[model samples]
Target chain A: MHVLILGAAGMVGQKLTTALIADGGLGDQALTRLSLVDVVEPPAPAAFSGAVDRVAADLSLPGTAEQVVASRPDVIFHLAAIVSGEAEADFDKGYRINLDGTRFLFDAIRLVGDGYRPRIVFTSSIAVFGAPFPDLIPDEYFTTPLTSYGTQKAIGELLLSDYTRRGFFDGVAIRLPTICVRPGKPNKAASGFFSNIIREPLSGHEAVLPVAEDVRHWFASPRAAVSFLKHAATLDSDRIGPRRAISLPGLSCTVSDEIASLRRIGGEAVVARIRREPDPTIGRIVAGWPTNFNARRAAELGFVAETRFEEIIEAHIEDELGGRFVS
Target chain B: MHVLILGAAGMVGQKLTTALIADGGLGDQALTRLSLVDVVEPPAPAAFSGAVDRVAADLSLPGTAEQVVASRPDVIFHLAAIVSGEAEADFDKGYRINLDGTRFLFDAIRLVGDGYRPRIVFTSSIAVFGAPFPDLIPDEYFTTPLTSYGTQKAIGELLLSDYTRRGFFDGVAIRLPTICVRPGKPNKAASGFFSNIIREPLSGHEAVLPVAEDVRHWFASPRAAVSFLKHAATLDSDRIGPRRAISLPGLSCTVSDEIASLRRIGGEAVVARIRREPDPTIGRIVAGWPTNFNARRAAELGFVAETRFEEIIEAHIEDELGGRFVS
Candidate 1:
């Protein structure tokens, strides 16, 4: 079946693309064609065998969505977004890119009017939930987002559900965890420490831990995230039913556990690579984040993630470091 | 305080305007400028000592929102929307006017670049919540709206709450119940039957009751709705805290209770004026509506609605009928 990947230039997008290329097949069927689109030109795949097409364009533009959908992709993965910090700092830009961009893409699918029902997997975030969270966030939690990024994603999920219910497309919005050990250089994300604490340490560089050792967060390795996306792409419509969004499974643990896992996998020398310098801004932001989630529905749906932080570290080592742990 | 009323040409706008004019004051504050705007020209007020500025323009148009915000009124009542049925029928128009228009206006206020905060009392609806309700919806109920109208309104509420929390504006989103005995000719609203059975019977016209008598709905009178708005305008922001949106207080009654109240108020003759005609479309839509609400937040905020259906009918008679059962 033909598949299209939007936002193929980002970290998750790149990993997802690599996974798709490596698998080379879904279920029993082999991939026939693959299309990738993003604002910036995505790197060419070295291992993809089937027909591959890449386009660079802004999804927010009037006809960009239409152009992408013209290929009649049986499955479409929409993993595009402006990050949390930028979205909060620039209100207009956030709404324009995150909210308006998403709506335009959905509308384009609806406007096709040919009764074409494509499996659309959208990437939502845990940011959709706010503070004073229950000890364990249930699937039925209300979305009262505290940031523009969260609000935009929440709104996107709502629209996706409605549009899917209207039979325009088969949509699934997966609220991904704060992907820990994100196999790249730390960016401007406020939650960057979730990745930096592990990524930098493994690479023999000390990473700043802005929050307390007790500060907890929900996490999934990059490998687990890709698997969730692929599984979401193939899930039966009958099984998913009307509630199209699900919080993907993840291991919930405190910063101390992360450090312990680092020591377990890479020894105490690696653990020493984490520098504790409490930045109040980062601490306050992390404090509002949910530390635990039930994610029962997602588990029931056959989506899985690393239950142990060591497994997460191992997965990162295998996927990002070519199956070798850096000394 | 200067009052700016968006959608000033609509029914609720006219009523609010009439009430303000008749009172000659807003919560003991002396009369001031009244800024009225809509796609069509708003009707000329009967007479008022305060200066009135009427702007005829489409709020959805580019740059129009900035123009409106330029006035920087102290109290802005946003009473604009495409009704449920129309919004559901035309997706593009609904998003353009309802969602984008609201966003533009909100962003306009933010982009003002000065410390110009206004009391923005937005009129939301119970439509924001959908089916499979908990009999009596509580303050924390999740908004899983079944229609485009509800989705748009819910998104607006989220934005309002976030923006208010960020200190961009002092905003309050009051989710009004279906206004009972809406004083006007019967429109095509799916919820129109809620008003029709009461209104048409009193006007000596035959009205259709589309659903089963057991079907319950939340309601508030036009006077009560205005009271909610006025109260929202004057509420201390500190009390509202982080969550700016609220489920306003409303009377909950079944269809049977409504007919019984109508019979008591206007006699069996008025009751006989109602016809039982089952409409599946109306039934399906109404079935998803919230029947009862706790509205604890609104109650705590001192915004009250009539408790009995009879009091609602009496309100219509007192406010619209010159204290006469039949005009």
Candidate 2:
């Protein structure tokens, strides 16, 4: 089987590539070729025996998407997007890259008429649901995104469903929860604090907690996110029906819960590295994000996530820190 | 006040134009100018002292949207779109006119900058909602549109909310229910039969009912639709907040209810003109449409509609049949 990964330079994309190479296949077929594309040139998987092509390309540019789809990979993982903060700050850049880029890719795939339909796994986010949400948002709740990035993702979901419905392709959008204990430096995303508090403290470094302890949100592990993408690519499209997007199952927790998980895994000394700094801007932005979801459809569809924040912490230690904290 | 109607040549557009002319203004402002545009040249509203410009234009084309926004009408009624059947049959045309056209107009308004934000009342449709609904779908139900027309409208709603949030435009999308007793010839829309049965019978002609009598659906009158647009335009943008689109309150009833109302309004002789010819294709399409909605938000905001099918039929008679129908 041939596989294509867009935004293959990103952390999740790199991890997904590693996992795919390790498994030596996707679904029931062996991986014979892998095509990776990103705005920056993506690295080739060192151990993979497959024919690997790494190319640097921007999807929003004319004909770039066409070049990416020219290979006609059996499955395409579209994870390219501008992070939330950057998108909100630069409106034109956000729309051009996040919205137009995704549309360009979808249109290019559609224009490849001769039934060259590939399984498309799109990475969406919980940002699609804004504030004033119910205690636990259901699978069928309305999407009223507060940010431009969320709006772009919501539009992408709409286009994916429509394109799939029109027989252009088989697509599934997995609306991932914020990946807790994200194994990287803090990013500009408003939700960065969700991971910063856990990742930094565990690394024996100071991390600012922007919101209140009681402020809750949804989460999953990076491991689970990668798994969601793999399962999504191979899942029976017939079972998904016309609503091509699904909110993946996630753990519902608060800052207090993360601290508790940190204490459990890294002890009080490590947890003490978290600094309490009430940044109202970040608090206000994060406040509008969805905290919990009843992703019943995804649960039934066999997409699982870390059941506890403690497990998320453990996964981070094992995967990112080699089963050891800086402490 | 300057008012611009994007599809002034269509039935609902023409009616809205006539209503605006009759009232001599929108809200409390006297009419100073009326800009009417459509693919076909729109008719000038007769005897109006206000400056009127009727132009034939396609919004999807380059420079057209900019020209329209150049006038910078105080209230712009965006009512242009290909009907459902046509959009589904011709995908490219649908995306070009419905999606691209709407976006171009919005972009043009935004680029005009100089803090020019007009009240944009976009006419969305109930097609935005798909089937497998509750007895009464709530205002916040997920939008999984079952048709290309619906998909385009849903995307438009997303853009409208995002643009409004960014202060690009003060926009409101009113998701109109099927306009029951729609005046004029039967179009290719699957729901066309809903109006055809009532409209043709009242006009002393035979009408085909292409579905079971129990097929329930939501509806409103053309008069109510015009009122919704007027209200949407004048309603305080502050009250709308970020969620700019709303499901308008509408009467929900079955085909039998419509026939009963038709009988009452047009007498037994006219009702007898209704012929039952169940077209399975149309039936399948109509089945996937939302039958009822808990449009509590719209009602709370003072947007009203007919409570009974009989009143809706009576509205058709008074508004379209010159207050009389053939016996």
Q: Which one is best on lDDT?
A: 2
Q: Highest TM-score among the candidates is held by which one?
A: 2
Q: Model 2: what TM-score?
A: 0.98
lDDT, model 2, position A287 = 85
TM-score (chain B) for candidate 1 is: 0.97
Q: Tens-digit lDDT track for model 1 on B1-327?
A: 789999898878888888888877678776588999999989998799889999898878889999998988888899888888888898888888888899889888988868999989999989988888887788877788888888889989988987887777899999999998799887657888989999888877899999999999999998888888888888999998777779998899999999999998899989998899999988888887888988888898899999899999988888777887552
What local lDDT score does residue B247 receive in model 2, on the 0 to 100 scale? 96
Pairs in steric clash, model 1? none
Weakest 10 consecutive residues, lDDT, candidate 1 chain B?
A: B318-327
lDDT by residue (tens digit), candidate 1, A1-327: 898999998998888888888888766668888888889988897677789988898988888899889888989999978888888788778888888888888988998988888999999999988887889998877787877788889899889988997889999999999998887777667899988988887888889999898888999988888899999999998899777889888999999999998888899888888898999977776677788999999999999998899998988888788876656
Worst 10 residues of 1 chain A by lDDT: A318-327
